[model samples]
Target: MDREQHVHTIDTPKARIQAPAFACDSHIHIYDRRFAASPGNGAHIVDRATVEDYRRVQERTGTQRTVIVTPRPYGTDNCVTVDAIRQLGIDNARGVAVLRPDVSDTELDMLDRGGIRGIRFTLYTPHQAVVTFDMVEPLARRIAELGWHVQLHWTADQIVEHEALLTRLPCKMVFDHLARLPPPVGTSHPAYGVVRRLAASGRVWVKLSGAYLDSQVGLAGGYADLAETTRAWAALLPQRTVWGSDWPHVTETHKPDTAAIFDLLGTWVEDEAARKRILVDNPAELYGFAR
Candidate 1:
């Protein structure tokens, strides 16, 4: 396939806003045209989202720093994400990567030098690329040796079932998308209880991004409930929680409005002091973002 000939037209929502100076889009993905190549072999072929694509969105959204997460379509490849960090420069970027059990220490050190601070395990996809409990222990130990965290993308149910193995890890754990919790609009959900316990562990951090993925209220109503749930989680462990935009809303029928997404974050951290902590202080400390 001709990579240059296939230009992706991104239909971003038209909500405008002044970008916040200290604000960071904590979660994003970048696909390179060369390495990740065509979205062939059962991979979903979306337009290549390069560092340049992200820079454009950051300019419009006023996002100062970003966390480039390794996406599923790319499988365990970290080349695209690593290149993005190098091109964007470390002062403005960090990354989460995927790895196989056999990944060498030398390779991990190289990634660390390239601005990768975390590793991710996807537990919710049909791809079934879920990391086993056995994999978590040793992998967590290695990541701990590198001073990085493990980002878990599991459904709320899995989180509950895997509590023992997850908490046993030596490294820090970051739960993506409100820990993939069930929408708070329902009955006594196990996810909420699990999240509460995980937050109390002091080693776990949750990203208040991707609420749109779990909410039933589309964008408007969905975000409100998400904000409320996030607020509750933050209250449990204000210092351990952070915010992210989950930009580019890949594979979704309705893309999220980036501007409004940031605005909604304000609702999650209502108190002025707490808002500063979650949006600025906490993320800076967790990801080692340069001041």
Candidate 2:
């Protein structure tokens, strides 16, 4: 693992920290127009972020494993993410899909066989979310039988507001983008307490990615302002945390430097072992990747 290895990325330079062998980028999205959005898809932009493009992202970040999350624009159509996993090789990639409550048992089994490891709820924007919050509990119950977790992309207020409903979910939880914590440092937010309580109870996982999404500073001073959010979670639950690239960032007017983005974990947790736990071990266990 050469620390100075020359790896290419879409908008950023090569990651300064050399990722350990079996390192995994636990969150990303693959969008291909050929897959076609489902009827449930809301009014949203569709982009061509194919599986081939993510291969270069893997190279740039020095990661060999990935967890491809079905983006909201596709609604309940998880074919794009599933296709990406197949193309990337199931041994190296897994998926977190979005599903309607009426999804049949056969469909769930098929997704399980195809390497889908979890279900995602994108509730941050209620107006655009096809799979609404009420659908979460029932789907979470269904997915739990398959040993899959429920990943959420909820706003800070949403998390606090739904604490009761969330607490009752049968499956484990992984919150996306630092659990979408309120910006300018997330510790003060009430959602922080909710996540911390859930995390302490052993049913929660938080991803230390997508700082630019909430940061008002906007990658200022190398995302220094976002460090508090990252460190707060990393320090609180090292085992229940993972890192991601959130590749082909669709919502952003300016895409982030994923390599530089990956390097921030290096700064947050100087311990090589701790970083490996977040980048390798925890995701392998959570996503059921082979050890």
Candidate 3:
């Protein structure tokens, strides 16, 4: 989509429930205008999602902190996300960056100083090359030295195939969008079993976000089963599970309604204690959110 087409102001719904202090939106993208001029192949251009925009969402949603994730459009140039963290102030935010395997230690140190806590490798989109097992080892070692985690976006089906490699990584592994599992199949699906087992490892964490992307029934029915699946995963690893809005919902023709996404969490984890862990405690611990 063109940058202009993605720039329209969206009316975010008022959060229906009060969010706890230290609450965090662990995943969102901030595209800058410069990325469009210097785009990568198959890149999806988007309007700049500035720090001001995030502040407004936080004000409305009671989100006290956020994790700015670098989008593919930026193509490993994490300037947009890094700049947003600096502009927003590091005390209230952290970031996940996209970096080439060969990025120097100096650059990685600079990123850590800029509030980056993780390195994300994408495997969901065909446009982005699939990351291999070989890549995982060295990358994991480097990130582990920095005390940063590795955030992976992959299809559920690929988990079993890559299980041994992923399990052996020295760094903490975060699975985005509940391992990007396909919905309508429910938690009983074999792939989710792999997710459960992965979570049981203590080193693997899962984001209870992006159900709309994986579900077959749009937002409504899609979220119900997705919540069921999340509950199962949460039961397996409550301390390791976290939640995020996946705000802006890029690429989808109809953007995911933000309020609807947050409200769905209530259904996913009905127990207040579990919800607290996913929304507050877990993120604070995983992302190293300063109290």
Candidate 4:
């Protein structure tokens, strides 16, 4: 079988939903321990999981393109993320890095040529993070000229407190894990309104991934607790949402069922064209992937 046409899944009955042509997993992490982890950033170390492993995930998920996020374990050292983009073929992969605000323009140019499309700050689980929240604006200003975005994984309350800072950043913003909103009051959360206002400005993209992240009801119910927030985002920002598997799931003690998580899109949007918007079109536009 031709490599690009390859389709495989980890499920016993096999995943019935295949991703559309050019569909992209807009967030993932590739860990290569051959490159040493930065000091105090070792909690996320998963042994030897590289691009080859992720390609199998792509096969399982039926996705052709992906965006590699610099995992928290690597801190500001983007080498692992950069190398994954090269290995996965830059045309089919892009990266979101973690960088210090003092990163030189030389290094910045190097990253741009290296297929990096954005930067991420993992404030949700902050511990020895090299970049602080205060550094966001300056770095946001720097990357804005490069057309790169600032991706955030802040908690809902953090979003509420940082409203002034969140609303005025110079570049585009991509929030992770359904904006980390708490359940039951999912869309009604104050942070959701802040995000909605931000989205209304046409500069925000939210990952329709990580259904298990904030679900009080847990995955056995197919993350039904997330349904309200998922549908609300789909209704409001179909053009701005993208999907991710959070592959390897280093943060979780139990791995999520990837096929089942991907299947959540079916629940989120029954309309296939809208699903394609999250799976294909929006990512191609956000990450500069060729359609």
The digit string of per-residue lDDT tens for model 1 on 1-291 reads 321222233554432544446776789888776675324425653663677766766655677888999877777778888888889888888999988678998999999999999999877763556355457678888889788999988888888888788767888899898887666652256867776676665788889888888887776474665666777778877888888877667755666656677777665665777867776778888899965
Clash counts for all predictions: 0, 0, 0, 0
Task: Tell me the whole-model lDDT of each prediction, alpha carbons only.
Answer: 0.75, 0.84, 0.77, 0.84
Which pairs of residues collide in candidate 4? none
Give TM-scores for every candidate, taking all chains together and pairing residue i with residue i. Answer: 0.87, 0.93, 0.90, 0.93
| Residue range 1-291, candidate 4, lDDT tens digits | 222122243233334687789888887888897787888755567853688877776666788899999887787899999899889899999999999878999999999999998998888766656678998899999999999999999999989989999888978999999899889989889999899988878899998878788888786688899988988888889899998888766665666656667777887788999999998899999999887
In model 2, the Cα lDDT at residue 147 comes to 95
Off by over 4 Å in 2: 1-12, 39-48
For model 4 the TM-score comes to 0.93
- The count of residue-pair clashes in candidate 2 stands at 0
Best by TM-score: 4
lDDT of 3 by residue, 164-222 (tens): 78778888889888877676676656767776676666788988888877777775464
Which portions of model 3 show Cα errors greater than 4 Å? Answer: 1-12, 34-38, 130-133, 220-222
- Per-model RMSD to reference: 4.2, 3.7, 3.1, 3.8
lDDT winner, 3 or 4: 4
User: By TM-score, highest first, what's the ranking?
Assistant: 4, 2, 3, 1
